[model samples]
Target: MAPRSPPKRVSISHSFTSFFLGFLIPCINAAPLGPESDRVIKLPNQPATPSISQFSGYVTVNEEHGRALFYWFFEAQSEASKKPLLLWLNGGPGCSSIAYGAASELGPLRVGENGVDLHFNEFAWNQEANLLFVESPVGVGFSYTNTTSDLTKLDDAFVAEDVYMFLVEWLQRFPHFKTRDFFISGESYAGHYVPQLAELVYDRNNDTTRYPFINLKGFMVGNPVTDDNYDYTGIMDYAWSHSVISDEFYHNIKQVCDFKELYWSTECNALVNQVFDIYSEIDIYNIYDPKCLINTTSSATANKIKIDGFKRVTILAGGYDPCYSPYSEMYFNRPDVQTSIHADSRGEKWVSCKDSILNSYNFSVFSVLPVYEKLIKEKLKIWMYSGDMDGRVPIIGSRYCVEALGLPVKSPWRSWFHNKQVGGRIVEYEGLTLVTVRGAGHLVPLNKPSEALALIHSFLSDEPLPNHR
Candidate 1:
């Protein structure tokens, strides 16, 4: 067997942006340049404010399917060349990471309530790492497969293969980041995405002569659905614990249908509908977050907040407004926005989650625990986090999944803090770290930006979550 490659050394100094760090320093243009000269976004809302650069384009992942994945990259605010490269993905199996991740959660500019305007996100992850958001698998966001057949099926296996190729080809477009410390990150369904993709990198990196030797370090995920069994059980536990549903109903649902059927199958459709009916009053994504019933009407002013539920959520939460969804759709669907970002518009418009794709998606592996077991043996840095308020993939489920690994605890469960307040709670295991963000739901960065930064900094820096007893 070829000798395993030595792990690359990484620098800990991070780029800080106001979004994540409470302040922004001008980005130092020290990295080798590519794609910036052509793909810069002149957003219709805020055209000239940002001095920092961004890149967006397509990289063909499958030639036979004529499949190409779309990506948007945000360079760090400082020392661009030296920072680690972090890829961000959103779950939904059928969702666009560009919309949910870059637009609402951690992008430089978040879509305002009207859906067409923009505002700065004070906690964009690019402040600390070079952020790359990809629309993976195909048929999600701007990524597409040209197969004329009406059937659409994207499973974990195909996602891994296509994304692996996407990264290989994407490097050809921007070669400077090839040797930089690379990490994979995603949320929700990306729980599956971040790991499956990382396993490929971990396996390939063992090759002595693999082209471009991707300098992979480790990975992080938030509110991930790692194991279908554990995730389903976790959500049920979360709902019951949070008083969202009755114990009798929870047990009845479990007795009637498997969690895997929650999304598909008529076997338990009526029963699942019962659970959803109780969950109907709330935003299943962030149970506590107020709902935005409609998109903001097209308006002339960037600050003109929408009248419906979207703006109300923003006003009530005082941080993340669930209303960003409609606005993101509006902005991304614009001809100018598509042209500015060089988006492919084979589809009518971008939906945050593509229902058809989610319904038609082929289930490959129910649990990534085996993959996790192998990667753990390899000693890769892995962190799992959850928004405490999020019921969809509750912290309880993620905690149960990690504990199933049975890794020894390096640090006993404790509260971790930022700015002298309880940021979250953390428990460290021999091979992984588990975190719960206080008052945060599925979207940690959007809900608790500072804590999210603190968490990410700890992961990227290879440090323990501060022992704020």
Candidate 2:
């Protein structure tokens, strides 16, 4: 594998910064705060059965602005105070959390046959810490915004403000958890969201400038594609090394693939074709998650062997792609999952998948822009992980992200042996650790549930990971 590249820190500022400060802070209660203008709104949500071992609930974050965040809280119902609180952000800049994080992965439920109901997930992350899976930035999932005319543009800064505002309001609603040690976790675009939000919480923690209700402890990101340049190069390299494409094609993509170019050229398309051809031959899962099966276009014809990719590369959000049909020959259909994810939201009884309750804004990378400097300066902990077989934000892409951090490796990369088999590997650095989950893809919690849960548990409790010296 090639050495990872460091992040090219970009400084960006928008006109909303002033409005952000004004709306976020105000004088109130001689206690250094403003009156709570928001009220928690409960939606018509049915709870997961008791046999499922988790709690489902939603707290209104900004009802007045028509922005509300919905979350699934999972816990074993421990009366113990101080249980860890985990805020999970699903990346899409505009994707639904229930689609990827909830139904497909860590949540205690899996989308069943018709996406009509759920099944108990044995490896739910809530078995350890109280986990909150939220559909953020309004217009995503059951979350909504009253103003229909609002621009749907999802940028970094907008997300941070809404997240911070929600956190403050959420803590107020769940006051019992206000002091609990909190960690933010997410994947793909969330790779950027988690850290940026964490910085905001940390900044407010030390300064008398904003809300002090957030008790943020740490953060985690999986298969993050933060740096645009690194992600493109990393994906191509992965495709080439895995024999997913030819060396010739790889060379062309490496030399000519510029992200700024909105669309792929003929050369790029050809390379993609070759890569998809290779992918058809490889299996996406070991135990065979029926969903991971690839579609092929090959048929024994009079002469040439041909293949075609999926008709639509349906990206629900945050670089997470859930397959509803196989490309080409076998168009495997998971209508249930399709309905559950809003991939087919047009079906009768459809609910908005985007959050409409969030404040009107665009995403800004301000938090990350000044993060490493501030956090690195504070000796804070930042962790990154990835499932091996995820194609959208593959493990190789994650490895590349880790390499760019440029932190000295505290522990060299090595397989994390489990039950006489390599489950994953851990690379510890000065203030960060990058991990790879074996036998798991895009959604680790779904493909490798037990392992994903265990990894997160160890991360939260500060336990030394097994097999790592």
Tens digit of per-residue lDDT, candidate 2, span 235-324: 777777765667787787777666434355667656656555566554432212333332322332211112245343343332233342
- Model 1: per-residue lDDT, tens digit, 1-469? 0111222222222222223221112234554566664467567786356665888888886576688889988889888888999998887778888888898888787887666677877777887899889997688889887884423446676788778778877775676777788999988889988898898877766753433357778889999988876787787788888898888987886787665442434645665566667887888878877766654345522323346533244445537776667667778878788888888677465677777877766665667889889988888888999988987888988888998899998989999877888878888899888888988888888877778887888889877777763
Best by lDDT: 1
The TM-score, computed over Cα atoms with residue i paired to residue i, of candidate 1 is 0.86
> Any runs in candidate 2 off by more than 4 Å, and if so which?
1-60, 77-80, 114-117, 258-370
TM-scores for all candidates: the values are 0.86, 0.71
What C-alpha lDDT, on a 0 to 100 scale, does residue 227 get in candidate 2? 61
What's the lDDT of the predicted structure labeled candidate 1?
0.76
Poorly placed runs, candidate 1 (over 4 Å)? 1-32, 36-38, 149-151, 208-212, 254-270, 295-314
